[model samples]
Target: MSGTSEGPTPATDLIQPNVTHSDATPCPGTEQIAVPAAGQTAAAAPSAPSRGGPDAPLPATGGTTPMAESAPAPAGFTGMDQQPSAAPRRPPAEPPFRSAFSAAPLAMAVVDRDGLVVSANDTFGALFGGGPEEFTGQVAADLVDLTSDPRIRQAYQQVLDGRRARLRCARRLKHPDGHPLWVQITVAPLAPESPNVLLSVADISARRELQDRLRHVQNHDPVTRLPNRTLFFERLSAALEAESYESGGSGRVGLCYLDLDGFKAVNDTLGHRVGDRLLAAVADRLTRCANEAGHGRTSVPLVARLGGDEFALLVEGSTGTEQLAELAESVLTALQAPFEISGRQLSVSASIGVVERQAAGTSATALMQAADTTLYWAKADGKARWTLFDPERNAHRMTRQALVSSLRTAVDRGEFTLEYQPLVGMDDGRLRGVEALVRWRHPRFGTLTPNRFIALAEEDGSIVPLGRWILATACRQARRWQLDHPDEPPIFVSVNVAVRQVWDSDLVADVAGVLAETGLAPHLLQLELTESAVMGSAGRPLQSLRALSDMGVRIAIDDFGTGYSNLAYLSRLPVSALKLDGSFVRGFQHEENTGENAAGQGEEHDGAAGRPSPADEVIVEAMVQLAHRLGLTVTAECVETCDQASRLRRIGCDTGQGWLYSRPVPPDRISELLGSRC
Candidate 1:
């Protein structure tokens, strides 16, 4: 009944329809009116309004009318105000409800009680990657991909049946184009008497990704962008049990453990930010290298970060130790390049220790132990290189392990012993003092050297206690020797101090107490330290060393050339002597073609292996000369023959200590050496 008018002059030819009114009256509240010619049917209504003109014709009904069919004023209409009669007006049109869904922002779908899609908003259509027309007649199940939980269907049915006020679930939706979107959907029943149910979906993809990102950060190191310990152990455990390796014959696992050399200097000199960037850059380079170096070979390396300045590669299914060695060499080569970080071109170097063994019967602890021990050797053997695990080295390690396992009880059991290596005066060959080295007489593994177990003690933090026992035992021996040779000059005792002893216990008090307990004069005692151990001695280190030195106790730099030696720093130190590293003296001696080592510069460092540069004997000689010039006594270490010791004595070296004098003999032998019996 609502439409526009068209022109029709004929009155008799008008058609009849649902909305027909022959008489034209003033519109009740509206100012418009429609009239048809007299005797005309609704369909034959005049096209134009007569406007009270008798000559006007009525509109015809193929929907043509002057008043737009005039709609019917109203069924109950009466003349306005009773006294002044006027026609009532038709009602105004209201917009359709379903049409508004076209522009809705949120994805929406209209479903019947039977769960069929009665309609869909553009957004809903887009959510399924289709148009409204494509979804209109589709079943609700058609829009929900296969990933939807079957349980969700029951929930959806509950929503449609009004058993639940709303059905909500978080699910990953599959798009028509195959990309997935995480979504939170709420399905609710529509209005009463409406056959439809409403589904409102929100794309929660970004939020889901945020959660995943948080999880990733939780397992990876921010500095290196490598999997940290948490993730490393996680993957290791998985590998231990995973079926992926089950398909092939079981192969042994190998590990390449590495530590950075001079990385701390870079961190201390440059800011940590630069260090972090450097670590990230290194991580990237190493990962690429590990993968490229026969990645899928017998042992493929899984590189991971293990805290600061440490990294590891897990070689799963390594064919043998050789494969791991190849991997290690590749890694070393990969890191040989200069790294540009924070706009600084810094040369970074690393030392790596390789331990390869069958994962069979090997616990993570065992593997880590072997790797760690080898790592120490790599560093001790000199930095910027790699070393493979040797069973011979491992046998030595097992002995040390036994010692460490027994160390905590050795003091209580009296299994700990000390053998003194005499520090002789190079000029006079007089005993300066005996550098006391501890040994262990294990019930199972015989006498053990200090090098065999000292580091383990240090690692387990047992050095503090073990070192105390060594000090006490050596002091007690010194006291006995003094009493035995009272008429002769009193000999001093030199004790090695473990770095841990300095940090964990009161070294000053410990040393003072030991001397007092033994009734030995302070001047008769000396403490030996490796170069690095004393390089940047802690404030406590300085205090302890000075406290002992002030009491007339001597302090000496042990293995001087092997560590980060800063001659300037040593000048300000309270040290009384410098023990040249063994490498220096040993390398300086050469045998001629008569099957003797030619002592020129000595063989290049690993020159046999083409690694670090050759050991420079001239440099060692220069160091000995320089130390004596500084009023510091020079002790030549590892002098294997009298000739080498003689050369050292000629070089003005203040002392000589090594195999030539006797391989660290027991205190009884020292008594002979000092008592003029040797």
Candidate 2:
């Protein structure tokens, strides 16, 4: 029995009823003793001499005492009235904790304040392949391998010194049979005031194995067995962080993002299954390329499949652009080879965008964005090539993006104005008609000419609204000129049209509406288009051109000789005039002189500087004659000198529009010219 004497013992603290004590009887005239609580000092029995006599009643303790019932004495003893000898009774049976500690199912041991093992249960002994008695005098930290780790050793010491309530950690241990075991160890004080601690160890190998398997499956791509996008971004973030914080590294990172060119065609022509096999093969080649690039390096590059046909190779601590470029080239060469799949040999090319830079100020999202844009450049430059990122080019692209985002809004805000370049009669030097040029009055960037943004407009289909605006404004200005200079003949206004305008909008309807709205006659308005747009015109474009021509609107081809200069199609199409490109006119800036004439009269012929070369003269003459034969007039552009104009007139050119007459001027200037002509 072990319990407190200060109060009646609780039933739970008493010795188990099942643990029977044998061959014992209470001494007569003595009170039954009470057990002390665990970890509490037990009261000593009254001394033999202190008791007045054997039959004398024991002195009363401060707390209530248990009384014994009268009963017959044991066979060898006298009746209940007999006095018992004062010799010290046999020491009370060993405390109950000993039994409980021995019978516990958990592997546990008791460690004294000095970190020595006081005792160990059978279960604890089996953990290290020894008997409980063998572990008793051993150092507890050494037995559990805690001494190897300084942090764990310190924590274990804290528990033994009673400074910490408990300590728990995990360890990888080797079993006596040579197999490895994963275990969780815990140490706690045996009692609130006791220096001894209880240490427990639990096996956790199965849980750890399951967790490892799940992590592998989560971070890898099933199709390629390569790290997936999640893991790829994770590693990239880590590399960037390390480059930013850690010392003594290259401080640069790089990536090669690529995809199989025309892979969709393969999937469409064949099947997805074949496409998948082709992608797998491509991944394998890319992996080998990465490994080859990593030779002699500290860390191998990571290859990841970022969904679909896209893949990326990440290199940490990259040396420079040269290293990344070498990797890209190797990838290109590897993918160029044909693959044999499903009894068919398929050939495919790859477009790779390589980006490498100092990792100091870059982020994962920004790096990926740069790589994607570079890949687009590679495709645009032509497939089967690798392109490195250029900051200047990216800046241009960013500016273009800004312009794109604001284009339609610019139109709605009326951020455009029209300028008219004079189209003068080659012989009379009189204004015949004016070509309408569009200018963007950008808020941030001062007035930009057509060359700066027209292509962008067409590509994005914003030219429809922009072209419509130009047409209406030019026609309105021409009508105003007609009213202001009544004495002069009304000159037609020629407006430039884009191919996209015909396909994206109803050109015929737009023209009719503008004419009707501005009260300008169709014959007084002309539409000028580049040769490339007008050549091989058919479908909606051909119909639109014919409709405009039939409405008495003039159709002139601008930049004629630069494109399909097929004069035969001139007869079949509804073209009204030909505007000879400036390149041909530039060739006439100087005349070729015979050797003797040039030597004798070099100074005198300086005034004839703009004479045409023989070949140019012949070509212009032939084209002018051929156009005349087809009932089409001719306009020569870029006429910058008097001699050039005179030569064009001599060649029977009908109109001249260039710096020679007037640069593209504002509507008010055209009004002044019209009034002056009147």
Candidate 3:
């Protein structure tokens, strides 16, 4: 649309070219962009981004041109006037300063001392939905849509007043779409001698979202979306402060640390995928319980995912250990049911460790240390239980942890030694056999018992090596005893086998090798199996026991009566001898009773109902006769007293072993006992 030129024409019409293009050429609003007035050329100013408006005139970049490497000022306006008068000025070829400023990358603006946007860049113009001229005399707060939060005006004013150099702030800017674009606004003095403040803004919407994700990962567990260790520690420390340091505060903080029991079995039997899913389900249930406990199912505690199958709960304002126990019970009850995952009904159990403290000594580190100790105790007591922290028990737990840490290298260091308790024959009173028991001369802990380390050895799979050493050492000693006492009968060596030792390695071969290496006959091995263990045999223990027994190994059921009540089932096993549990022998006495008190009216059965009454010579005699008929030699255990030894010998019992004979004297001690007696 063309119009005849008026004498004093409008400034925009002077640069608005009327040249038309064919369909092949770049169309209007595309490549043929309108230019600015002569005064508008090179009039770009640093933008007041925080103020949100266009500025006029970029401060000259030194004396050098902006395009020059490392230079500042644009090439001294050289090419501007070089255009010929007859060159038919087509908007100066490149875009005018006004149009370029309207599309500048940064939301830049120039604001006066009155806090009004005099001019701004294209990005600033787009940000405020106003032209540079229209933005003149407009206050930054007015241009930024600060109607919701006008306090943003003060943030920019501080920069202008020299109280702040660069004001960094966040605000919601009204976008062209009528929505808010979160922008990180940066406002500062534009030029050294200039009266305006330059505001710079960045659309930080995406960066803010990224920051939120990073914060989530930092503060919460990736698997459970619950507060993680770091965040939990922070919250716990705060809770403790509230309980102890806060004014008028008298409550305590309770912590529960739970680890899923048998979870590794699930992970190995099922896959890790199922294990992860099970963990998630566990987290959900735990979160629910933590919310309910003291807070009555409405208040949520600081539930944290402390990595792996472990989770922790922080209960603030807890009163005492009773509350701690209740929290632990809640956790145990919550995990008592089955979790269905990966198409399997997985029953998982957790060991909870509860620690509560009213004072400020409850540091995050201290609480975690105590909780961890308690958790271990719970697991040790048997899975699916909770253990409260006790200072005394913590000492033992710490000692055990120290021992476990050092146990791996204990064997190589020769810290372990075997002591043999000779299994003496009841009839002949001769050293017929020896049971090997291991002891640890721990460097610091000193003389550790089997109860202290054998379980640890089993856990770390060190039992395989340690057990092998035990067998070989015991066999070698047995062979030495036989050689040393050539005139004496061959003494058998009984060694207890760990289930882990049997399952993880070739136990039969290891046993055979130990016997062969020590030159001890297989029958002289007497590998004892408990009733529970012998009966618990499946494919491996069964095959292994059978193979060894086929090779002349006399299998004896050790610790017999202590395990199972069923004596009839023993006949089905290959057990040749029954090692009567020592507990049964503790009752042996001189006086004998046939249960008839004067009249034998089935006299009200005193405590002794099943077995013969106290001092029952007849009951002892009957047990021996029954065992002999079954071809099962009865070995009476723990003949601790002379009366006991004499009484057992008179009762027709086959053999016995206990402190009464010698109190499990070592080899040299055995040599001493043997030289003094039969």
Candidate 4:
């Protein structure tokens, strides 16, 4: 009643009733009514009940006696006759409504249209640090911070205007003790015609605190406290979506995929505890680097730990590759210093792959893939560096992988073939031997050369078996040629050997078995090894070569001058021939004064005028002499011109191999050459 209308409308004007008597009660033919308070208008008052002469024993129309209308009215009650009661009725005992309002658990308050508190329950008063009497008449808006939020104010207004029956929101309340009180406030009109609102508040601070902790745990890494991969990917997706809207899909995005070099070694050698500490230190440094890099940018880069020994940075709206390169450089420089953990100074480096592209055509998956591939490239190109994404390089790598995957089966499928290149005597121009070059007659990429798949086989250890196959095939072919030309000098067949074959395979036994199976003389089957392989030969490798030499097999050092030309070391090995590298042969044709000296050999003139810098010629002449003195034959490789051949002959070289004689041909072509020589 206190907040029914502005200034408290009189009790008579507040209650409006259309009263009806209940026939089920013991009050037949009698009217039960609520008499309006003082100052009621006659039109608003109920008609006076007709008196039936002391109610005529209260007519029993419904088998019940009616109350006499002449009964005395309670004190302070106004009857229909507008007569004062015989005695002023004592004020009604304390109502149940007041007891309920006082006992309500939630903080409850009644706010009038003027936003003033008309009545507040004890809970409301106690919650705000006061009693009900002290809170009464206070401006409700000033008592709490709800109106500070426009949304809460709008909700309040909506309820006040009757547009909404109830409105609720969660907001922080201003407290007298200056402590924050989070609460859920609900507003509802007290009644259909009431101008007052029933506002209720419930504390929710504890729930909110729990939710905040959960969110932190979900989005962060436990070890580093940095955002984990989940949060990083979420942010990356958001940034990409924002770029699509902000720049018409033209914004550039960049990512740096990083892996710690030799992280496994650290984990294995130092134990996981030390590895964990090192990982934490690395994470901290990465976070600092990302922050420093984004100093002046609108969107800060997000650094996250993808997993063990792996991390990434998402750069939104990147300027270009140069910017990404700078970021990568910073990361590398930061990790250059040693990390002291558990009293041990551990030095580590990282390889980063950077990828930047227009956000319009790229996706998170594709971007991450490119970055990962680039990172592998960095590791492959010798760790501790950064490599940019190159589509061409990726394609090439994919092709190499495809070839490697197919190589093991290629041998079983018999897709491999061989071509023979003649090694012609430099002086006589006759074939002394033929080099067997392996080729892959692939079903997809037709006829791949050995250079393409041989390294793949070596890396995967498939070369051991492939090398055995080649050795057997070459020996059998050479035996056939030898048997066909019984009356002619036997022509030898040289087969290249991979280093892995020498180390991983039983080279001595394989060669011996192949020679016995084919009945080909070991001397007529030459095995050529690159200079590095020959120079690095030691222990078992050296013993294998000596064993082959003892078996009457020819051992030649191919590509001789490119590696460590340790003459003293070379003379001690079981070597029979040296094939001069082609790079030196290309310089031969350019030299003047191609005249043969007095001994039918090139002149040993140093810096002769009009002679192409005798540097290469001088080196070749010296090598030929060295080989001859060691009782080893010297073959000039890549001899493509008559001048090159003549120079080699004058330099006292034994043989020449190049396109000038004939490109590498099939075994049938070699057989034809053999027949012609015969």
Residue 94, candidate 4: C-alpha displacement in angstroms: 18
lDDT of each: 0.73, 0.82, 0.72, 0.81
Best by lDDT: 2
lDDT of 2 by residue, 1-678 (tens): 222111122223222332223355545555444544444433333222332433556555432221234555445433432333443334345545655655666788777788877777777878889777678768988877898899999998898888888899988889989998888899998667464788888778899789878887998988888999999999999999998788877899999999789889999999999998988898899999989998999888899999988999999999999999999999988987889999999998889999999899999999999999999999999988999999999999998898888898898998999899998988778888999999999998789999988999999989999999999999999999998888998999999999999999999999999999999989999998889889879889999999999999999999988898877779988888999998888778544466776688767555534344668778998999999999999999998877778889999999998997899999888877873431
lDDT tens digits by residue: candidate 3, 552-598: 88787876656654666666667777777766676664233455552
lDDT of model 2 at position 414: 84
Number of colliding residue pairs in each model: 28, 4, 28, 2
Lowest lDDT 10-residue stretch of candidate 2: 1-10
Off by over 4 Å in 1: 1-405, 590-617
TM-score of each: 0.45, 0.78, 0.59, 0.67
Sort by lDDT, best first. 2, 4, 1, 3
The sequence of per-residue lDDT tens digits that candidate 4 reaches over residues 108-226 is: 88887777777777788788987776766788766766678888788777887788888888887767688887888888877776767888888888898898799889988887778
Ranking by TM-score: 2, 4, 3, 1
Rate residue 569 of model 1 by lDDT: 86
Return whichever of 1 and 3 wins on TM-score.
3
Tally clashes: model 4: 2
Count of clashing pairs, candidate 3: 28
Q: Is candidate 2 or candidate 3 better by lDDT?
A: 2
